[model samples]
Target chain A: MFNYIIVGSGFAGSVIAERIANVLNKKVLVIEKRSHIGGNCYDYRNKDGIIIHKYGPHLFHTNYKEVFDYLSNFTDWRIYYHKVLAFIDGKKVPIPFNFNSMDILFPEILSKKLQEKLLKKYPYGAKVPILKLKKENDKDLKFLADFVYEKIFKNYTIKQWGKRPEEIDSEVTARVPVCIGRDDRYFDDKYQALPEEGYTKIFERMLSHPNIKLMLNTDFKEIMKVDLKGKKIYFLGQEFKGKVIFTGMIDELFAYKFGMLPYRSLDLHLEVIEKEYFQEVAVVNYPNDYDFTRITEFKHIHPIKTNRTVILKEYPKDYDPERDIPYYPFFDKAAREVYAKYQELAERFDHLILVGRLAEYRYYDMDDVIKRSLEVFEERIR
Target chain B: MFNYIIVGSGFAGSVIAERIANVLNKKVLVIEKRSHIGGNCYDYRNKDGIIIHKYGPHLFHTNYKEVFDYLSNFTDWRIYYHKVLAFIDGKKVPIPFNFNSMDILFPEILSKKLQEKLLKKYPYGAKVPILKLKKENDKDLKFLADFVYEKIFKNYTIKQWGKRPEEIDSEVTARVPVCIGRDDRYFDDKYQALPEEGYTKIFERMLSHPNIKLMLNTDFKEIMKVDLKGKKIYFLGQEFKGKVIFTGMIDELFAYKFGMLPYRSLDLHLEVIEKEYFQEVAVVNYPNDYDFTRITEFKHIHPIKTNRTVILKEYPKDYDPERDIPYYPFFDKAAREVYAKYQELAERFDHLILVGRLAEYRYYDMDDVIKRSLEVFEERIR
Candidate 1:
């Protein structure tokens, strides 16, 4: 009865489902394992009117005006710039480490001298990568690069990745950099804001079209089957003619014909504190002191008047597919080869499409996932 | 030959002259006492290709889209957000004092507690004036207000105005505020940028029309005369029929008819340092230490590659009518009363219109002067 069968209700599956149903005026069914939509972006307001993300802190910021303009149709936006402070040497300094961090952490004379060298050597607002900065030949610059790596990036990388600083791949090592300017914002996107209503409300508006039907608490595997040999899809014991957009893990769709792709998960411990506020900012990273990577207080994100505040502590761990939610895909060379194999196998079935962080085995921010989904719809589905 | 006469080449006069010349296609003459145009906004490139402001730093930033749009016709804008730091307790902190300043100045525990109280009490990203904040009933918030006033505002006011902290009027005390959030930028305006070309270029473009005649090194009092009792104006032995837009000092134009209005002038000490750069940011306030109020490095504003840099130290002093150039009209109760008499006397002449900081006897920023000129053109000139 439906023209398209979406295997997940995340941004990847939902955006395409919405376009197909509204733009083409065709019937589409969305299947989901979770009771709600919005995938990792899902957030709900508690009794105290504080919107809390069920998974973790998800901030929406993008430089693409098209993406922002497209999303503006569904929800009103509130100006929000995310700020993070990393606990280093008994003081909390803004990260990705910048000149302000240099001032708070170093001695007055040394800090001023270091700043002079940096401004002279680099552009005023350039973000110098830790790995690239480490390659600098200048004595003071080299010292600064090393000082940043050892004091700030080293311990954080170990806790988040479960590997020594040197063991991490060079490509992954350059992700965090030292900002030359004093902008303390975590992300320097041109457009930064949160949905005025919440992310869940945006999903509700996108899927409210008459041609769209949703199935909660129902996994696609329960009613849909992929015949690997024949390269065909079957739905409810009948040969399904509709295209199947798979957003779940690519390896699982073929029933682990080759092997499982590696992933990292998190243990989110949420607590209710009997105080007006838990911290100054929304998130604070304990790089050197704790097992948990960071603590996020929801009151800062969605301001409220209640005295009781909620804070979440995140503990990174190896992904256990049987229990934990897969948050990030492992990006080492070996994992890429395994993911390429699954991608090749899925291409053989013309009706099967792979998208999202899980299906593509790539890490995507909220705006990145939406941008990819919009592009895929034009290139493949349309 | 001129249908309108403008007394100064500042924003207030130039904007009016440009409008009358281009929009109305009428002849207008601009009489500037200074040798060059652009008055206080004039800047020139030194031998090292550094664009140095002759008077002081003049940054353009405005929230009114119309004002930005109007100025966009003359020159391209370079995104420039002014960042300032004040030396307090041997550490440089951002001011208008913010949460970042609080973190660096106070003990960590005290800073954290003060931040919590501030966040709970005030809206994020608010510029709460020192006078208003000092009236807070909450104990922690009250302590924070008093602490900020003593550390950042008190001595700076004394240095700039040459008055004890208690002697300064309440109206002037509220100008600087404690920002609730950590935006280190001196301004939080929606549009903040500098002209890619020097500000003098803007004035050159403004008065470039053939109908706009510029009279350099000529005081308006030389060719123009105002009869206060008769309410008549004569230009060069002829009865001038058109409106005379006066941007010079109101007291000087009327020859201090009632009494001399007080003004404060600056002794700018421009030094060319051998060093590549002077300080981190463009401007740094020496609140407690230096004889001068602040030091401004020109290279920081207009970035260029040169070993030698230019810095200006401003020493505030009482205005001398015979030898000194008036920069600011002293705003006190007695000064305001005397200024009002001149204003009332100016209103008696139908063809005489007064505008700008000097004529209005008020402190007007660059944007404010432009905005006022546009309004006056619509209301009085156009």
Candidate 2:
């Protein structure tokens, strides 16, 4: 009989299992539905002899050194900085907007003037909410905010967030800071890097330990039938005792009592080119006049130079109940209300600790996930 | 005659004009190459009276209080948070990877076991890499990561990045972090909000200062024919005498001396639905098995409480010199080499300040752009 049963093998479940077994020094059983492990941050070689991120381009950037260092133990470290470009008007511009982009897309004079104007407008230590001098009657920097939102963020937001500037939470804008200085790095962090080896290797190392049991191609729902010792946790709704840890969606765990939460789905078109190298950058964003929001060049992320290359065309799609994988959770009032109900139910569990992206319904970086998991162990499990 | 000439009425240009004219009491003339004044961030009412971001949906999200506070002066604030979904194999999963996902896609038992395995192996701070993980590895964390990358990220990355995981830089993976705790809020920040009225209005206010002059449907290339009081700055073969602030691409500024950088472009398929609302979330992503990458419902972004709705289907394409707007910059070694040459030439301009997304050749968020521009002003212009 196992002392603990955890659901899913992604960061959430993996973290929980490792912590519990290590702290309690008890027998732990981890079951995975897929043939392999790692929920979404998995990487492996394909038939085409290309090492690809199986789900999507999973970039591991974090500000927390501990999380960074922790994951480093699993995989080798690579000094990679995430660079993105936006394909607009037949020109390649850096993603998030930057210098060096001006002359490529715009005529010289126009580019120069625009730069000067931007510099003058955004002085150092400017305060939020950006207040435009002209629209005095307007509050909350609506006028100037709208202007930036339109050009810098709007269409892309519509494509990525599936909403307009007005519909999104104000916090969304807060996440993407407007820079007064000219440094074009995707993330603003002192410590940013990627695993030299694939993220899969890191996960493999994290999971490869003794005093643990792993079953692949096995479903937790089926395992629920047998009586198990200890507490049972239903991640995907399989009954298991022995301190069950659920990492799936909270609403799904409760069977969508508050109506299905809105979620945006995606469709990706992947192709390989015979050229030794493809695009100049790793990721290219489509902000205007594009069916796809972005294109990713695998070579940009992985560091292996080869004669052949692979790429993925990212297309946004509507969440379909019948035929799609839900990637993003819609935290609209309706969804939130539904989630709230599930949260109540989840809180009722005594031994079960609901954690991870799925359990919490929040988007987190890899480091954040580790930090959060560790926090849970420190506060509850331990 | 205008005392100061400002090109491009986008946020970058408008903000500068407004600040200099309003605060510094300087006369400014604004010129826009596009027919409209707001540049790429233009939004207006269509025939249906439904507000549509002309360029695209721009969701304003930032972390800097100053940037947000500055925009507050121009317009009112709106409170909205966006959600995204992924459509794969006929399933809708929350984006950024969340809990409610496994139930609809994987079988109940399998999903539960997968969760268990993840927890068992990971076991909170295993301090071991998944790669080094042994068969007794309870979490199979690495395997799960591989599974996610394969099922979702792999194909999508190939379509988005144009390179395989092995070939790309590790930095890409680091940028996308996995979540350990479930919170499904795509971004975790203190402040999240948007512009109340829209983005275009903000531009109008920012550029409406008395010291600023406005010109639309005019290109700086045409204006270069007239003389300005400044040193002669040569871009490729063209010469300019005014203090030039470039916001275009670095390669084009140098006339693609090292050869034009490769960038991916997009083709958008738009549809105007006559319904008040459509879909559950705002954005949806398609990882693989689709010609297009994703679909976006405009109402999710705008939420105008209208009977009319708009949506866009995104498709990725090879950037053609003649068609499509280049959105992302390709940072291949060749392009970088060419950019290096351009950089050398750019240094000759004592009065010129290269700014915006293109001039820098680096990926920048809106905050980054604003911050960068401000830095240039403080260090160089001031």
Candidate 3:
């Protein structure tokens, strides 16, 4: 009865659902195992009337104007430039190891020398990843790179990925950069802001189209039977004539033909406190000292005026398929080889489409997820 | 028979018990209503092996060398200089409204002007209370004072004390100050550190004296009866021979004859996160925005190389006499008057000694509480 059946209601599926209903005038059914929409992006007003992200803090930021503009259609924006601090050597310094951070961490003479070297080497306001910076010929630059790598990146990488920085892909370390200038904002994006009325509200607006039928707390595996050889998808024992869009784990979709793909899951410790605020910044990274990765104070991101605030401490753990939801896909060489075989198998059915972070087996920011969903809709569904 | 009977086994009672047993060489019985001995200062390793304060984050910092030296006898120290950041207008600035904060908050011209004015007005490194700074005649200084009072002090006071700054005692406002210099450290105490193990460890060592008898999960009121007219105290309906030291709420002791004294209670939300760390600092203050006052990442205070971290969000609520433990006394005029009456009632018995924050109806930092207990032993019990 549906033109397209989408599994999962996160940014990937929801964005596709909205486009199918609105752009193509097609009936779309979105099946989500979670009780709420927005997948990991799910946020709700807690008992104390503070809007909190059930997972962790997700800041909406993008260099892509199309992605930003598309999302703007769903919700108004509250311009929030996110800033992060790393706790190093008993001091809270601006992260990305910017020039200001250089001044804070080192003595006056060393700081000035470092600042001069950094500005001369890198363009003003440019972000240089630690690994790239480490290759610099100068001793001071090498020392600065090593210092950041040890103090801010080394332990955090081990805790986050359960591997050393050198073991992981260079792309992973490249994501966290050391800035040359004094800009403290975490992301250097053209568009950076949170949804005016939380992320959930935006999802509500996007999925409000009459053609989009949403059934949450329903897993696709419960009803849909995939016949890869026959190239037929059956729902509730009947052959499903519509196109199938699977946004969940690719390994689970194929029943682990190439064995399970690895992922890093997170245990979020959330608390509602009595005070109006908690921390100064939206997020603070503890790379060298603690067991957890970071602490996020929700009020700092949302900027709601209330008597109480909400905070989440994020602990990274090895993803157990039995217990935890798949968060970050492990993109190691072994994970890639396993994913490649799954990708080849998924190609057997023309009607079956794989999209989003989980299906693609890649990490994505909010904007990239939206952009990916838009591409899937335009290329396959249309 | 015990030589001394101590009620409420927190810092006050524990310090006195240690002194009586170790210094005075006499048997001391300590009665605690809570199952733990540290009272509000209690901390323990949670299920995740992260040391968390059962009550809240209690950073030990004091200018009194004697207080530091005395506590050093019990536990080793991990020097932790406490730093706090105030979330104001989407930026995490150093608290105490220092020169660095001025630079971050205002424009370049305004920041320089304010910096010059602040240095000229107040001595370098001196913390000027907002009320005292507001007394400055210059417009720029007046604006700075008003700005800090409005941005940082006002809402936090209202949430903390349920009062406006002027409504509360000047002493309360005076406690939080604005520094003229760039020093971001919260306190300029002579000694600032956490117990190398944990606060609970220190309490364990302090109360380990052979002559000290600890009876946890037992309230003094349950076993002891005070006869003001007879000038006698009875334990389990029998006459008690030694001096009685009460550290509980003074109003509760007198059965609230002059009406109950006001106090604030905290609801702590604790979670074990997967990350190695959470916030950049041990504590972050949300002055303007949320209902909860602050979030504390415990590992930053007590650093141990582990894979996960623990954090606490503290919510402030009105003290429910039936449900909540009194954390902070509401030192308004009417509450002071009520406490004075309780003091008068207690003065009748020469053998009964009142000590600790609750008994005195005052807030004392950890070191001050220890100093007060030492003074009580030398001046009265000795």
Which number leads on lDDT? 1
* lDDT-superior candidate, 1 or 2: 1
User: What docking class should model 1 receive?
Assistant: incorrect
* lDDT tens per residue, model 2, A304-336: 645678898878877886777667766766666
Question: For model 2 chain A, where is the 10-residue window of minimal lDDT?
Answer: A125-134
Candidate 1 Cα deviation (angstroms), residue A331? 1.8
Candidate 1 C-alpha lDDT tens digits along B1-382: 5689899999999999999988899878777776467889999765455788999888888898888999999989889999999988999899999889989998999889988888887799888998888898878788888887887788888888888878777777877899998999998889999998779889978987767766554567766788877888987556788899999999998989988998888999999999999999999998878889899998889887667899999998889998788987788899889999999999988899999999998889888999999999999888
TM-score of chain B of 2: 0.84
Model 1 pairs in collision: none
- The numbered model that scores best in TM-score is 3
Order of the predicted models by lDDT, top scorer first? 1, 3, 2
DockQ comparisons of all candidates to the true complex: 0.00, 0.01, 0.01
lDDT of each: 0.85, 0.63, 0.84
Show model 1 residue runs off by greater than 4 Å. B1-382
Task: Give per-residue lDDT, candidate 1, residue B193.
Answer: 93
What is candidate 2's local distance difference test score? Answer: 0.63
The sequence of per-residue lDDT tens digits that candidate 1 reaches over residues A1-382 is 6788898878888898888987789878777766567888898765345678999998899998878988998999989999999988899999999989999999999889988888998899999998888898888888989988888888888989888988777767878899998999999899999988778888878876756666544567766889999999998567888888999999889998888888889999999888889888999999889899999998888766666889999999999989999898877888889888889989999888898989998878888888988998888889
Q: For candidate 3, give the docking quality class from DockQ.
A: incorrect
